[model samples]
Target: MSSFQNDTAHFAGLTEKQTATARLLAEGFTAKEIAARLTISESAATKRIEALRQKFGGITKNELARLAREEFSGSPSSHTVKVFEKNRDFSRAPDGEKLTWKNFDLPNTDGFRNSMPRNRPETELNFSDGFTLDATPPWRARREERLVPEVLDGEHAAPARWAYVVGAAIGMAILLLVLLAVADALGNLA
Candidate 1:
């Protein structure tokens, strides 16, 4: 037996990231593929593997992989392929048949689309320009309402106007301060 066969002490010092890298390596993944799976750069993945190598008594990567496989050999790996029956098509539903429009006996309303009523006869408000402003499905109309800004035209308008003016003044002041700071930095650099 190899010295690593009975050794679980080597895994005790590993960080969670290193453990995950080791698990992937054990499942026959290349460092590049491990990087993609871990959402890290290839160099980062290689560094992690190298770190693992150092921790495992300066062993080669292949030996590290073998150790990893043994370490995780008892647990189920997702990459392990299960045997399927030779007569079965696993991708397709066993009882399902191919469906087309003819299966439902649907009418072929090809070019007669314009002849169909755009809005239901019972609908209270339907704009000719294709806006359904009524409340059957309230969310759609509410979405359209949110897209348009309200025009202020009453006692509240003066306060709103003043608020806009104040906001503009503050924005311009901030912009002027930034430009002055940049100019000062540029002058100092020269």
Candidate 2:
């Protein structure tokens, strides 16, 4: 048998929807795009793709697309196959002339090779004597290095403590309202 017939025969067991999903996948359509094309939910499209994967003996999506492409290439379909032109000129001009360093318009390379002989101005700083200071600042000092006064250690509360309480109260109120609304809805259903 021909390769096209052999490839198509492999997917003969797939349902119409499964075949369509595979064809869309081979055409580079995402699950969301496939869902839109087939008028199905995105999750449904994903499930169909997963089913195709399982049906093909746990092959990857790319492999499935390859198989689908081989299967559909012989069949006449409305989906247009896109052809991309490759860039074959490896840094050469269109007329086949090789590019030179002068094409970049770079600076002179004469003195740049031996930069060790270049002289630079020295940097200096002057500080007065007896400028001793602690290595760690007071704020960042370790707890053992710093001692807190008894008056300052009385009580410490979080800044947003009231916000949490208010949020809880509002959430409870909303929950109670939803419960009441649901109860009323259920009562009217009788």
Candidate 3:
């Protein structure tokens, strides 16, 4: 087993950004090395590492480094995945087929808030309109699988509650009763 595997407590509370710094650091990276890996400024890496240490309440740089190596694999964590999934707005295509990424949100990112991020994976899953049907790898198989569920999920979004139907029926009955009362009043006046 890796020496790092047993030291999980030292790496607790490392955020996504810190995990990145830690992975580079574990490979004997300098602050500049960490920055280069993430395409950020050296001071950005340094300050981020500092902030990470503070968040974890580490008393020394070594302690911070220890935590980062323990927790930071330089990729999104399970919790991060959950956050992103929760933020994404899923829908069937307007035609109720074709699982599309045409205008799909990226879950929790600010990019998703303003607009959908591009599906720019190295395999070139994009179509002519900058959309991708590649939810999983090997696009054709996944695309076809999406068709039935897309239609059904969209159809299911329409209200299926008994309460809504009952409420509508009650509302219609009340409106008819009001009309009948008005007609009776007019007849007495005539």
Whose lDDT is greatest here? 1
The CA root-mean-square deviation of candidate 1, after full C-alpha superposition on the true structure, stands at 24.2
The sequence of per-residue lDDT tens digits that candidate 2 reaches over residues 128-176 is 7787785778677475743644433445434355555688899999999
User: What's model 1's overall lDDT?
Assistant: 0.69
Tens-digit lDDT string for candidate 1 (23-57): 99988899999999999999999999999987766
- The order of the candidates by lDDT, greatest first, is 1, 2, 3
Local error of candidate 2 at residue 142 (angstroms):
45
> How high is the CA lDDT of each candidate model?
0.69, 0.67, 0.57
Candidate 3 per-residue lDDT, tens place, 1-26, comes to 11222235445545677766777776
Whole-model lDDT for model 2 versus the true structure? 0.67
Q: Each candidate's TM vs. the true structure?
A: 0.37, 0.37, 0.30
Candidate 2 Cα outliers beyond 4 Å, as residue runs: 1-6, 75-190
Q: Cα miss at 33, model 3 (Å)? A: 1.0
Worst 10 residues of 3 by lDDT: 77-86
lDDT of 2 at 144: 75
